[model samples]
Target chain A: DAGVTQSPTHLIKTRGQHVTLRCSPISGHKSVSWYQQVLGQGPQFIFQYYEKEERGRGNFPDRFSARQFPNYSSELNVNALLLGDSALYLCASSSATKLFFGSGTQLSVL
Target chain B: QKEVEQDPGPLSVPEGAIVSLNCTYSNSAFQYFMWYRQYSRKGPELLMYTYSSGNKEDGRFTAQVDKSSKYISLFIRDSQPSDSATYLCAMMSAGGTSYGKLTFGQGTILTVHP
Candidate 1:
């Protein structure tokens, strides 16, 4: 069975632009979460959705948003991107509380 | 202070050597401790997880949690070249609004030479 899959394996955008990254959770999973990992740093929590409802959010700014669909697929959108926004964006899915992550999308904001 | 702290090591070890990675957190409420491994330019893969304070062992990997010290560790026995990667420690605690949320450490990069 497929674990988790993310879209646009890589992405690039300019400051003030917007980018959306997609992810498909493991089949039958109900929880999907997003994380951002900058160069030389660990993944930082962004948001988590369960049953298509926002379950939790991290300390990220309002420019970062996400939504989960009925099928447990997820999208992470970042607006007004800054140079600092360039990082590896990861999506993780879970059947319970333990997370299974995808290969992730490498985002570069110039 | 940050909730979790980890040493970012460019630690080099020979194949078949034992490897130990560690993290410490200030939050006493954290109940779940997890270790994740990330390859270059990839997402983290869960390696070890332990709930509360205790030890959990999987094939060749052992995780230890000490609530008294607010510390957690992951040890790999008979490390292989394939075991080279960044090891991250994550913790989960109640945020007053959610049941589970994770805080991650900086991660340590390990290189095992064959």
Candidate 2:
């Protein structure tokens, strides 16, 4: 089966702009989570949605938000982006125990 | 201080050497420990997962967790050049408001030269 898939593999945005990243989870998976990875750093959790409900959230600012659809796909949106927002946004799909990740969308903000 | 701390070593080792990577965490509630491998400009892939404290081995990789010491380690035996990548240590709480959330350490970059 295909693994988690994310859209717009690369993106470039300006400060104060808004961007949306999409993720489609593996078939039969109901949990989706978003993470941001800065250069030379590990991924930081942003949001996790299970069954379309917000199950957990990390220390990110209000500018970041995410939601899962009935089909188990998810979208992560960041508003009023800053240069610090530039990073790779990763999406992961999970079963009861194991979690699988996508290639991630690289976001560069100027 | 970050909840999880890793050496972030740009460690260089020759092929056939045994490599060891470690992480220390401050959260006592973290019950799930995992190691991930990431390549340049790519997402992290799960390498090993362990719960509580014990040792689990898979092929050339072994994951060890010590809850009492709040520490974890991953060992790669007979390492190859393909083993060169960033190794990340992650932890997750058993339950509560933090369920399903994974806390990660700064990744350690490994270079296994042939």
Candidate RMSDs in Å, in order, are 1.4, 0.9
Q: What is candidate 2's TM-score against the reference?
A: 0.98
List the global CA lDDT of all models. Answer: 0.89, 0.93
True contacts kept of each: 0.59, 0.69
Model 2 lDDT tens row, A21-46: 99999999999989999998889999
Cα lDDT tens digits for candidate 1, B8-68: 9889999999999999999898987899999999888998888899999999999999999
Clash pairs detected, candidate 2: none
Q: Candidate 2: lDDT of B98?
A: 63
Candidate by candidate, in order, the iRMS in Å equals: 1.7, 1.3
Model 1: lDDT of residue B13? 98
> Over 4 Å off in model 1, which ranges?
B94-100
Error of 1 at A11 (Å): 0.6
lDDT of 1 by residue, A1-110 (tens): 98899999999899999999999998998888898889998888899898888989998999999998877899999889999999998998876658888999998888
Among these predicted structures, which one has the highest TM-score? 2
